[model samples]
Target: MCGTEEEMREVAGRICRNYLHGAWKTVEPQALGFRRISRVARRSVLRSNSFTMDEPKKVLLRIYGQVHGERAMDAIVTESVIFTLLSERRLGPKLHGVFSGGRIEQYIPELSEPALSMKIAEKMAAIHSMDVPLSKEPTWLWKTMGKWTRTVREERLSENIHGKSVDFEKEVEWLKKFIATVESPVAFCHNDMQE
Candidate 1:
């Protein structure tokens, strides 16, 4: 379920109450210019309003089952990867805090054209510099991809396609094989980065 304005305000208030308790402050909820998925709390840039905070301060909060377990895991992994990159000064944004709920990060608001490009380049460089240790353990990428592909195929199959057939399994297998052949040095990856 999507959170209403009241719910969002409540969440923000709770964040302030729990983390910034007794600190000098005012809590004002401003609409952010982003589309957020309530399920995973994923935000994507879209045409919306912008909220200005007094300052971008970090706060920590708990993550309940409301957010998917896999999303939680992904957040943890992303935080760790970004932390290593930022410590080396290879990324633009600095991490403010990592809490049970999620991570808070800060970025310099003002940037010239050249500086922005430089920052992007630095982020890429950091990712390329990571050393990904080899593991005998199973990787989830293939399984996750397979599931995604299967879902797509099932959706297509359900659509009435007269006198037409698709080899869903074969296609999925080919894609899996192609993915397995790709090998690259591990680097810090944002996986998700946008305004």
Candidate 2:
């Protein structure tokens, strides 16, 4: 139900009060010294006005939740992992403070377009240098291929589009053969670079 402006303001005030009253005790909000500048579709750009944080720091923050849950304990583990990795490589944001509260990261305001591109390219190169062994286990590959084939089959069965019959087994076989042709010593590849 919709409410008058005053009523809506009261509701918002109540919600904020509840939050301030330790309703979300486990996850305390901490200012990261940054603000979201703009959002276009699914992409968002965050700007930091302080001198300590940079684009890389924001990237680290963005991906933090991917490997970790939103809970406080999970945040601790994730932060530790991030710090360890960053320290090892000597290429991460400076850790300002840590606790049950959210992280306080240093902020950097401006970056030249060319410098940003170079920084991104360097990060990409570093990531691509990491070693990832190709799976030699045939059973796993067969299982994965089987699952994919089944999914495609189900989709085809549901759709009304009728034309030439698709030989799924042949397609799966071709895919398997194609995958086998890929040389080993695979490096981490991030196809999506737009932030």
Candidate 3:
């Protein structure tokens, strides 16, 4: 099933209440994709016969999509570890809580002005400089690409270049051969950098 807003709110509320401090008031869906984002706020109670309302301080609820149960667990664990490291280094958002499917993280505001290219490069350098406690084996890229290629072929999805069919399996084979020709160093990479 697609990730609905109601489902997102319910899950976010449950996560915030149990894992985070404060009385979580509401959860509003912000963005949705492979991962889901929601803004959660806390309730402020004021005394003295006054109908009081609190200013919303937002925190983000990030829910991971289900792929394969056991298979996905390792990836989640690795992500949690990496996020923790990055947050502590002030490179990524602060991690609030972790649940079965997802985690709560500090909400970062969108920048009104575009960052300088140098600043962006510095952040990327910092991320790459991190010595995360995960496997250094660079197998995930090829594995993921292979899996996607297989799925496409199995589903009989057509790809054409100039009205001629293209075989992804063969394409992958070609890439595998040509890829190693370029010397590339494996570093901690932000797989999802696009906003």
All candidates' lDDT scores?
0.49, 0.43, 0.60
| Span of 10 residues, lowest total lDDT, candidate 1 | 42-51
Model 3 residue pairs with clashes? none
TM-score of 3: 0.67
- Between 1 and 3, whose lDDT is larger? 3
Tens digits of per-residue lDDT for model 2 on 1-195?
024534433433332233322231222223222233223312122222224332233321221222332355653565455554543564444444333333333333344378877886787687567543433355645776677678878787523437557777687789878978988643445354424
Arrange candidates by lDDT, descending: 3, 1, 2
Tens digit per residue, CA lDDT, model 1, 1-195:
236856655555544444442231344445322234334543221121224454443332223334454455775665565554664473546554444654444434344477787777776676656554434344556667677667867788734457766676777689768867888533434464433
Better of 1 and 2 by lDDT: 1
Point out the worst 10-residue segment of candidate 2 by lDDT.
41-50
Per-residue error at 46 for model 3, in Å?
Answer: 19
Top-scoring candidate (TM-score):
3
lDDT score for residue 156 of model 1: 80
